[model samples]
Target: MSDKMIHAYSGDEIDVHWDKRLCIHISECVQADDPLFEVGREPWCVPDEVAKAEVREVCERCPSGALSYVDKDGTPEQPASENTGQVVYNGPLYLSGELDIEGAPEDMPGVRFRAALCRCGASKNKPFCDNSHIAAGFEDFGAIGQSGPGLDPGSAASDGPLKIKAIPDGPLKMEGRLTLKAASGRSAWQGTKTALCRCGASKNKPFCDASHRAIGFKSD
Candidate 1:
């Protein structure tokens, strides 16, 4: 996935930019308003067909930051909140806010307001979701465990650069202000650091329950 491939769609008040490599194919844009994002049509997206506000709202919902829009005034839309992550129901781990993903692909954005990281262990795009979870029938309820003390809601609000270190063939070690949420928008866990499972073999679901070692899951 070359970082140079950027698809731009112009509108009356806003211009939308899409990085196909970052797209997870969650269909959030299409579901928001099909007329503007018809799958089989040329150009695929017609931003002018919908109100600028509506288009912006839909684009913001993209979990992978694959969709971004620039207003006529040249202002770019920002993330809704601070550094945070949410485990989608039987899907990828959705993240947003100030983030610095270490060791990411050269083509990937250095920083993004949102991203969908693969937790299902099936995505061809490592660390990023590619909608392979759907075809793989991945399932998880994102249950929290009785581990160490998690972060307080107030503490989780700190605006800091979240650091995500992807371990070669291992779990994702994260540090900095973070609020881990569940599918129902409930806080499952909040902390400044954590080792999250990526092999999808953890008995603890999102957490590293040491199942990766037992299963000998290799990723490097």
Candidate 2:
């Protein structure tokens, strides 16, 4: 297991794990009425402060895949039934389903469910968003534009692994089925393969416009 992984809280029924490296501070865990996560507390996250169901709900809502939990007897966290990539307005790409992120660290112990990937080309953490888009003043309305040539209808009846390859100084090469959507929850694209922009210079927004080459964006 990764030394950086935080075993935040554990109890007879559940255990909470936090990956600091992946957190972008979306604040979902701290917004509940009872508030399982308190900023000033020594442990910060006290699963005992709330019910197991509430803890799991908040953790599942973490788009960055930073928070996860294990249950002793109840149903555990599972991968999404369908693969999806949701474009966040002026922010990262939120991906869910069975994901196989190329070069991602595998030492952390948790259920692999989701990830927030960089789109602004300014993240110190390449491929993963570190919320650098806000500082960089990256602006994208997160609207749907061109779509990939889709597969036969019902081809995606079952969830499959979505492979994301972060190309050096280029785009995120996605392989396997994906249902890409805009921030408004509208379908943007449906396909098995596509190259998404990491460089903020893409005129096509979510899709690569070869702007990485012109802007000399470096992923390393």
TM agreement with the true structure for every prediction: 0.83, 0.90
Q: How many clashing residue pairs, candidate 1? A: 1
Q: Which stretches of candidate 1 lie over 4 Å from their true place?
A: 1-5, 33-35, 105-111, 135-137, 146-159
RMSD of each candidate relative to the true structure: 3.1, 2.3
Poorest lDDT segment (10 consecutive residues) of candidate 1: 103-112
Residue pairs with clashing backbones, model 1 = 151-190
Model 2's TM-score against the true structure: 0.90
- After the best TM-score superposition of candidate 2, give how far the Cα of residue 46 lies from its true spot, in angstroms: 1.3
Candidate 1 residue 45 Cα shift, in angstroms, is: 1.3
Candidate 2 residue lDDT tens string, 26-74? 9887876676888898788888878888888888888898898888786
lDDT of predicted model 1:
0.77
Candidate 1 lDDT tens digits, 1-220: 4446678899888888888878867789888744778888898898999888888888888889888777897667765566778888888888888778886654444236788888877778778888888898888987665333665656753446788887877888888777887777877677788898888888887887777778787764
Off by over 4 Å in 2: 1-7, 109-111, 151-159
